[model samples]
Target: MKLITVIFSVFVLSPLTVSAAPQTTSGEIRFIGQIVDSACEVGRAGTLSSSESRQIELKPGLKLDVDTYRNACSHDALPMTMTFEPLKTSTDKGIVTITYL
Candidate 1:
């Protein structure tokens, strides 16, 4: 009976001792992108007419020249602009958000 008790105690306590040791891991996280300037109003040179929807659609890997939209910055807002250049290998297909601040 004493031998059985000893064996049972060893089995129950062995896992607790093994799990007490500290564990560590290593890896690398890389971010690929760019920080752009604030968006300006689309001017007369913009392709979309006033009656058209505000949304602009583009195929994957295509680039849009925001400069063509011209700078219609108002006196109340800061003068800033941006361009649209999709990554050549990017497969993401959705609405790209343009935040104004």
Candidate 2:
């Protein structure tokens, strides 16, 4: 399967060892992910430019549902033109396209 690169920026609060409280900084941050389609780009991409970053948190063992992509892309079909037709899977009923090198 082919994969695409995704990037994200994050901001977080710094912990203090003294009697002072934690502080947040607007600095360079980054995240990376491999996605199969475009819907994943729109749903998962974000910037740490505002208060939204303060409420966002990252955790280990994250999983994404395929239905999220189907729903988001339902209304907007990506424009494509191929010589051969796409094949649908018998099990999960997914549309698969083949490319040749």
Candidate 3:
């Protein structure tokens, strides 16, 4: 009788102990944005769908050209400005300061 009681208690309490595992209460933030030159905007402001965004794959340490995405940009769209901001100047320096226009 005692053996049966111990087995039943073990089975019931095992699940309760497992279910009490710690859970994180924090939330996640996702930001998706794209930049284009004025010429590209004039010719065609391409749309980046969520599915396409997911399909884009970049290899580590590989740099991508913004012109690749600016397919509709005019050939005359020269002297474009591409600013990669919020970049650290050095390991000792913090995030780059940005001044919005």
The model with the greatest lDDT is: 1
Cα deviation of 12, candidate 2, in Å = 19
Q: Against the hidden reference, what TM-scores do the models get?
A: 0.24, 0.16, 0.24
Clashing pairs in 1: none
Clashing pairs in 3: none
Could you tally the backbone clashes for each prediction?
A: 0, 0, 0
Angstrom error at residue 82, model 1:
28
Model 2 agreement with the true structure over 5-94: per-residue lDDT tens digits: 222111122223321533445874544456544431221224322222111112232221222234333344433321322245443233
- Model 1 scores worst on lDDT over the 10 consecutive residues at 65-74
lDDT tens readout by residue for model 1, 49-76: 5432233234445333233232333334
What is the overall TM-score of model 1 with all chains considered together?
A: 0.24
| Per-residue alpha-carbon lDDT of candidate 3 for residues 3-72, written as tens digits (9 for 90 to 100) | 9999999999998987676544466544445654432221112343312111111223222232323343
Q: Model 3 — TM-score against the truth?
A: 0.24
Kindly indicate the candidate among 2 and 3 with the higher TM-score. Answer: 3
lDDT of 2 at 30: 40
TM-score of 2: 0.16
